[model samples]
Target: MSEGFEKCHNEYTLFTKTSKEGKILIVNLYVDDLIFTDNDEFMFLEFKNSMVRELDMNDMGRMRYFLGVEVLQRYDGIYISKIKYALEIL
Candidate 1:
């Protein structure tokens, strides 16, 4: 949470340490789950390790689904949708 990154007033938003060389890391917390992304791989790993050290939680690896939303990671970028939820509702 606020241990490593700067906490946003909006409750669950966190941003990595400011640095021109390091990519900014963004983290959003939803109850027990955390969704995080960074432009730099090293920065991401550093943040992840910090989280692990600060909080007792499992690293679920790459996010594929969360709260019924399907997360698809591609070379271009990430795509998120609730197609499965929509189908289920249908």
Candidate 2:
């Protein structure tokens, strides 16, 4: 995680790394779950692979839900909602 990654001063759970070309990779840790994304596909894969190799964690593929919030990733953009959470409470 030391490959130019720096901890966010205000957020201990957030880490960010920047490539020389200015591409950014972001990682967020919540409890035991980790979510990461990178602007560059090659770099993203490299980072993901590295993490998988070092940590005993499974890649659950794409994310659908997190912390009771639904996430929808579309070609156009990403969407999130709490409708499922609300329904469960009803």
Candidate 3:
């Protein structure tokens, strides 16, 4: 959980590079988790693989960082909230 924090802002960063081009993103990360938004599936997996190759990371499939929040990703959009943290504190 967030423990004693009153407010939380998630952050994260991802870089995308193809054989021809490159891109970058900056998101939020607080505590040991994060939530990011993107739907470029093919490029997304490619970037994830690139990250795996660069760092000795244990690939835990997907759902990398839930941050004590709920992540609902769909064809429409994504849903995220710190409901768990709120409940814990209450």
Best by TM-score: 2
User: lDDT score of model 3?
Assistant: 0.46
Q: lDDT (0-100) at residue 40 of candidate 1? A: 81
Judged by lDDT, which candidate is best?
Answer: 2
lDDT of each: 0.79, 0.91, 0.46
Query: Clashing residue pairs in candidate 2, if any?
Result: none
**Cα TM-score per model:** 0.78, 0.92, 0.50
Candidate 1 segments exceeding 4 Å error:
1-4, 7-17
Q: Write the per-residue lDDT of candidate 1 for residues 1-90, one digit (tens) a residue.
A: 354568776664555555477567777878777788888888778878987898997988899998899999988999999999999999
How would you encode candidate 2's per-residue C-alpha lDDT over 1-90 as one tens digit per residue? 578889999999999999889999999999998899877998889989898899998999889999899999887888999999999999
**Winner by lDDT between candidate 3 and candidate 2:** 2
* Tens digit of per-residue lDDT, candidate 3, span 10-88: 3123322223343332223444433233345655565456656876645455452374776666667667878777988
* Residue pairs with clashing backbones, model 1: none
How far out, in Å, is residue 86 in model 3?
A: 1.6
The C-alpha RMSD in Å for every predicted model, in order, reads: 2.4, 1.2, 9.8
TM-score winner between 2 and 3, please give it.
2
Cα-based lDDT at residue 4, candidate 1: 52
Single out the weakest 10-residue window by summed lDDT for candidate 3. 2-11
